[model samples]
Target: MILATCVAPLAAFACRFNVRDVGFVDLGSDPYRLYLYVGDSMPMAERESLQSISTATFYDSNVKPQLLPLAQARQSEARAFIPEDFTGGVPAAVLVSPDRKTTLSLPLAKSGVSVLQTAWEALEPIVDSPRRNAILEQVFDSYGVVMIVEGKDVAANTKVRSMVDAAVSETTSKLPGLEKEIQQPPVVAVISTEEMEAERAFLWSLGIREVKEAPRVAILYARGRMIGPVLDGERLNRESISAILDTIGLNCECGLDRKWMQGVMVPLKWDRDRKQQVAKQLGFNPESPEIRIEMSQILAKSGAGQGIHRSKIIGDTLDELLTGYRTKGLAPENPPKQNKKPFAESLEMNKPEASELMLSWVVVAGILILIAGGAIVLFARRRES
Candidate 1:
C-alpha cells in the first residue's frame, strides 16, 4: 500500500502514450506504395537507376517500393489508373497513395541519369523552411506542435494566433492532473501566406493546398501526424484547441479510436538519427518492429471491449527491448497492470456451491430448535416445583 501510494503520483506525470511512438507505428499502417515498372528488354543502366530509389535515404521507410515487370504491370489493377498513351517505356514509376486514391507517374528515364534524378525528386520532394525546421525540432523535443497557417486577412490571422497561446497555456496548467505526464507543453508555429508556396508539398500532405479565406490551425504530434481535422472558422476557438491538446495528454489505452487520434503525417523524412533522439526521450525505440507490432495491435483492438491487457503487453515488450529498465530509461514508471480479474470471473471463482449453503442453513436451524426445547423443559420444571 505504501509503495503504491508513493509511485502513483510519479506515474501520473510520465505519459504512457507517446505521440512519437504512436506516429512511428502509424507509419506501419499507412505507407506510400511505389511501383517501379520494368521489362525484360530494359537497359541495365535504367533498370539499376530505378532500383536505386528503394535504397535512397530521402525515400524514407514509409515508402514501400516494389519492382514490377512490364508484362505483369499490364495485368495489375494499377493498369487501369495508368494513362493509355503513357509510352514512357521501361524504368517508369507510379506512386500511389496509401488509400490508392491518388497516383503520380514518373515518365521514362529519357534524359539520361538526370531524368532519373528528376524522377527521384518528383517521388519525394523535400520542402523545408526556417519555420519548418523549428517546428520539426520542437515536435522532437516537446509533447506536440500546434501550427497556424496564416490566411490573407491579417486581422483574422492575428485573432487566431492568440487562440494557440491561450490554449497552450490552459493545457499546461492542466498537465499535472493528466493521466500521462507530458514531457513539455505544445509549442506554436506559424506559416505565413508568403511562405506557403515553398511548403506546398508539406501543406498538401496535411490536406491544405492553399489557405485563402481564414487562417487555419493544425495540431501535430510525434513525427507530424495531425491529431484531428484542421480547425478554422468557428471551430478555431480556445476551448476547442485546449480540448484536443487535453486529448493527446491522456492514456492511449483510454479506448479512443486510432482514427480519431491519428491523421495523415506531414511528408517528412524521419531518419534514424532523429528516431534515436526521440527514443532517448521516450525511453524505448519506436523503430523496433516488436514495439510497432504491439502498438498496431492496440490500435486494432481499440474500443473492442475485449479483456485485452494493453499496458501489460506494451510494458513487457519495452522490458524486452531494454534490460535494467530503471537505469536505462527503458521502463515506464509503475506501468499499469491488469491484476484484478473481471467481475464475472471473480464471482465464479469465489461463489460457494448450492449444496454447501443448504447444509449450513439446516445445521443452524437444528441448533436453534435444541436451545428452544431446553428452555421450555426448564420452564416446566420451575412450574412443577
Candidate 2:
C-alpha cells in the first residue's frame, strides 16, 4: 500500500456520500452542518469573519454552512440540544449533527469565526500511523477496504488476517467483470492493537472504541462507510465477504433499499484536487444540486430521505453508536410528488403463483433430461450395431 506524503488535510467524505458504493458510483452522502447565528444588528468584523469562514467550509470541504437569524436560532428545533450553560451569544456558531440531534455551540461573539474554523479543522485531523495513512490515500479510488483490526492474541489475529487476505484475493480476481472502471480492487488494511490506541480518533470514527475481540473485519466502501455490522467470531466468513462485495457490485439502480447501502464512514482529508479527480473519473459531480435532488427523490420514494427529524436524535453517544457521525434508520415520510400510487401497490408487484413457477422449472428440467437420454441411446445403438 502506498502512503500519503505531506498531503494537505481536508475533510474527505464530507458532502460526497452518506451511503455505500458497491460499484464505482458515489450515490451521495449527507453533509455536516455549520449554522451561523446573526441578528438584525451586527458588527461588520464578526459578519466578515462569519462570511469568510462559512464560505470556505462550504465550498472547500464537505461541511454545509448556513446563516440563520439570531431569533430563528432561538426558535429552531436544534436549540433545545445546545448546551444551556455554554451561553454562546447571538453571533454564535452551532455545529450540528446530520440528524440535528447533537450540537456543539461556540460563542462567535467573543472568539469570532476562529472558534468555528478550529472545530472544522478537528474534522480531518492528521494521523500518525502509516497503516491508516495508506488507507486514507488509496480508499478514494478503490471499490472498498476490508480492514482487519488485529488483537492481542497473535494466533487469532493471524487467522482472521489470512481469511481477509483470501477474501480480498478472491474479490480482486473478479473485480474487472464487476466494475471494469474501478482503478483498484478491494484493499486489505490491518490495524495493530497498538496502532488502534494511537489512532483512537480514527477508530472511534468507525464506531470502534476498543478491540473487544482480538480480530474483527470491517467492510468499508463508498468513501469509508462501514457497511453492515462489524464482523468477528462466527460472523466473519467467506459467505459474509461475498455477500457484501456482491451487494456493492449490484447495479446502483437495482432497486435495493439504500438503507442497506448506507454505512458509517471515517472522516479523512479530501482536498479539492482529489475531489475533482474523482468527479472527472465518475463522469458527474456527486455533490451537484441535480444529483442531490435525484438522490433525495430516490430516498423520498423509499420513504427514507425526507431529511432528519429532531425527535430521532436523542443522545450524543447513542447517536454516534447508531449513525457513526452520519444519519441512519430514518423514518419513512412520503414527500409529495405527482401522480403518487397507493402505498401497498407501490411496494410490490404481482407475480405468478409459486406452484406455477415451480411446475414450469420442473417441466424444463424434464425436457432437457429426455433430450440427453435420447442422444445417449442413439449413440450407443449406432456403436453396437
Candidate 3:
C-alpha cells in the first residue's frame, strides 16, 4: 500500500505534459484546438502524455491522426489535413526545423541553429478571413507554451534552450499590434536548465532599465531537476531575474527550485516593501492572508461579490480614495502650466496701432459713401433738365 501510494504521484508526474507536447495531434476541445499543432514527427509517447494532461471537460485530445509526407507538407491542400489547419486555422506557436525553411524569413539567424518562427506569414490572411471570428474566440480562450526540440545531433538541454529563445524572439517581434489590441503589454518568461551568465550580462548592456514593468523578458536557470518552482523560500533575487527579463523586452519574475532540473519563469511582479506595508495597514498577515471581520467587511464593501463587477468596483473605489487624498492636499499639486503666453508678449509679436487702424477704416467708408452720393445727384439733375 505504501509503495503503491508513493508510485502513484510519480505516475501522475510522468503522465503530465511539459512544454514539449506542443506539436501533437489534437482531438477537438477548445484549448487543444487553439494552442497546439500536430506534426508527423511527434512520438506516440509524447502524444499520450499530452492527452493525459488535458482535462476532457475543457478539451478532448483524442482525435483521428492525420499524417502527411514531408514533400507534400508544403502544399496548402496537404497542410489542410494537419490538426491546426483544420480546426482554428493555425497555431499561435509554430515549430519548423532549421533545414525546413519558411517561405517568409525572420530578421536574425544564428549559424546552424534551428529557428521556430511565428507562422504569422500564413496566419495573417486567415485572420482577416470572414470565417475566422470563431477561431479567434478559441485563441483568446487558450494559452499554452510551445516547445521545439531539435533532433539527435543537438543536446536535449541545448535544444530546449534554443527553442525557448526562438519562441521568445518570434513572439516578441510580432507583439506590437497585439499589445495595442489587448491594451496591456505582453509578458514572456524563459526558464532553462542551462545557465547562460554571459548572455544575461549582454542583455543588461542593451539598456533595459527596470525588469518588473510590462513588455519585459526574464530568463532563469535550473541546475538539476527538470521541473519545479523557480525559487524556494522567501527572498527572491530580483536583480538576476530583472536583468534577464530586460534583455528580452519582457516584464518577468523568476526563481530556481533545485529539486526539479527546472526553473519557474513567470511575468509577475512583487514589491516586497509595498506588499508588506499593504499587509500591515490592511491588518492581514504578509505572504498569506489571515481572515478577520474587518478584512471581510472591506472586501464585501469593495465588491468581492462576483463576476467582472468586483474588480471594476474595487478599481473605482481605489480611484475615489486617491482622488480624495489629492483634494485634501495630501498629494503633491501639479506644476502650473509653463506654456501660457503673457499678454504683453503676445501684443508685442502681433501688434497693430488701434487709433491708426480705426481712422483708416473710417476714411475708406466715407469715400464709398461720397461715390454713391455723386451717382444719385447726377441721375436726379438729368431727369429735371
Name the top TM-score candidate: 1
In candidate 3, residue 95 scores what lDDT? 19
Clashing pairs in 1: 13-181, 14-181, 15-181
lDDT, candidates in the order shown? 0.64, 0.56, 0.28
User: Model 1, range 220-243, lDDT digits (tens) per residue?
Assistant: 887767776787877777766765
TM-score of each: 0.64, 0.53, 0.18
Q: Score candidate 2 by lDDT.
A: 0.56
Kindly report which residue pairs in candidate 2 clash with one another: 10-269, 17-28, 17-29, 18-29, 22-248
**Model 1 poorest ten-residue lDDT run:** 304-313
> 157 in model 2: Cα distance from truth in Å?
2.2
How well does candidate 1 match the true structure in TM-score terms?
0.64
Q: After superposition, how far is residue 12 of candidate 1 from its true place, in Å?
A: 15
TM-score: the better of candidates 1 and 3: 1
Task: Judge candidate 1 at residue 322 and give its lDDT.
Answer: 26
Better of 1 and 2 by lDDT: 1
For candidate 3, write residues 210-323 as lDDT tens digits. Answer: 232112222332100012122211212332222222212110111111111112211111235534643443233323432333222222332121211111221222233233
Residue-level lDDT tens digits of model 2 in 1-385: 0112111112221123223433223456565566776664656676676677666655644466676655566687645544454344545566655455545554444344444456345333322246666776656667778888887899988888788778777667655544224557778888888787556656655556687656887777765566666777777776566555544543333334555555544544456786687777666676577776655655444321212221222222322323422332222113335547776775554354465467657656666777789899999999999
Top of the candidates by lDDT: 1
| Better candidate number, 1 or 3, judged by lDDT | 1
